[model samples]
Target: MSLSRTAMLLALVLSGAQAGQTVVAIRGEDFLINGKPTLEGRTWRKHDVEGLLPNSRMVQGIFDDLNPETARQWAYPDTGTWDAERNTREFVAAMKAWREHGLLAFTLNLQGGSPQGYSKNQPWHNSAFDESGVLREAYLVRLKAILDEADRLGMAVILGYFYFGQDEHLKDEAAVIHATDAATDWIVKRGYRHVLVEINNECDVRYDHAILKPERVHELIDRVKRRSAEAGVPLLASTSYGGGSLPGPKVVKAADFLLLHGNGVKGPEAIRSMVERTRKMEGYRGQPIVFNEDDHFDFEMENNHFTAATAAGASWGYFDFRMKDEGFAEGFQSVPVDWSISSERKKGFFRLLAEMSGEGK
Candidate 1:
């Protein structure tokens, strides 16, 4: 076996994680997998890559639309049909390649993000929770399979519980709270140590529920932490803000780590400034700052969102969506995704990732 593989196995054993499971922990501003810093001892271009969790946004990995009317929209070209099982199978098959390309983590949402990448109005019913905030068994089964695979590969999952576009699925605030507690309970029961809880994607975005909004979102975050701690699993939890905005005092104080987005932010300098401003925000603590959903990418450039975030001591994530006139091979967020490392855009991101994470060497 390779030395890295041996070390990973040893780490898993030492950390008391079950066989074929990944354990994620936070140490100050560093992210640790099985008690060891991610990208251990690695640096790129005078930037400290060690301890950073390089990730991407793959929110729709196990996506399925419960609404049959809209389900047909995500049909694969080859099969001319939409199969959630096939989508998940292909997603799992591509994960090892993603890991090989130096991706340590990715974001997944139960209520998936916009299938159109950035939709103004979401008419599709795509939620894992029912109107009562109970998780559907079908979705849980698929989620378990994905989480199991992520564990076996030694990768961390930033598992998001809600998304703005799909929040209407839950009936009310009570249901939202129930979903949060239920999700947390499910994760604990499943014995997943490598999962971080993202309460909602972009809490400041349009949401039907007030509990999911920025001011009160921390209540859910604190609830997740409390519920998980009571269960003895103690999962790390947080919520993210919209692009270029600083996290409010509540989230800043309550979150285990800060999650940011670069979707609407412009330029590398702006990215750096966002990170800087976050660090100085009220109730700011020295937790790891992560940009888990950034749509900007200029991988070949000396400075970009990825580079700028890293230089400012924040981990960055790639959020690629199907742009106008792009084919299936282009975007990870677009429906009917080609999960392989196909297309120039995909190759560019992974190529730079490999170089930065020392995977190429």
Candidate 2:
């Protein structure tokens, strides 16, 4: 076959692969892309990530609105009706812009949790799964659009399957399992390469459902892995802890990768200590470590969250929640996300990421 035809055929084969399939692999301590080392010469405890250090964010509310009560919802005015074309276009544009600035991954939640407490009457139950345990078609379409765009932009997505607050919307643990199976099967069928699975966001949070609680969280992680295996997809899976707490030994052993949060950590030394401490655990085997959610905003400080994480040889993610201020843009976390790099926090993060990843040049 001609080179063009050969490339086209290879693409078709890849596009048809199962979800959770081995799109990204761990090769001796480095993450491998198409059998080649990525994030060259950088390794945490002698193991390097296959691709770029994922400069990720918890952008759960980007595609959907946060407040269901208001007529003019956060993301778009028409909350009930899904605008496939406009939604995809804006999401793709945002992903492209972030990628150009060296952001390689994002942490998106299927069921987003509210940072504000439940008593505040927050609409924290916005979820992709309905009560009947079916993944919403509209949500799936939006997810596919983002994943497709991420693949095209050479970026990855850390897709969170459940959130504690909204998980109650499901009837029971079996329904949760059914939802998991269905979602994973769909992902497998779609054959997305640049995606990772986070079984639950902050598993330590107080979940109404017993199955999703902290003590039994590893079971769900295992369940996701089993679903992937059964579907012939190689899914990398992990669950996160709440702010200031390290994952227990069970989670550490169960997860394919270690995810740590630095929200309440005081300084860079504390961050370094956490990473070092995790490495010293008994079952620890030098899996790739990432600080996937940290809300510390000491951007100009010397020992800020970003500097602390990178210095300790771990990948980092930014988590900033912002309420709508009259003069400010909504790119930062919280509701009504601008989706553009409008806030100083977003700009500074991308700038620093570009500089660190050598994409700035």
Please tell me which predicted candidate would have the highest TM-score against the true structure: 1
Best-matching candidate per lDDT: 1
Off by over 4 Å in 1: 1-20
In order, candidate lDDTs are 0.88, 0.67
lDDT of 1 at 265: 93
Q: Which residue segments of model 2 deviate by more than 4 Å?
A: 1-22, 42-52, 61-88, 115-121, 323-328
How close to the true structure is residue 350 of candidate 2, measured as C-alpha lDDT?
77
lDDT by residue for model 1 over 174-267, one digit each (tens)? 9999999899999999789999999999999998999999989999999999989998899999999888888999999999999999988999
In order of appearance, the predictions have TM-scores of 0.94, 0.83
lDDT of 2 by residue, 94-204 (tens): 776787776777888788546331223545457788876698766665566567666666666788888776787889888888888887888877776566788888888
* lDDT of candidate model 1 versus the reference: 0.88
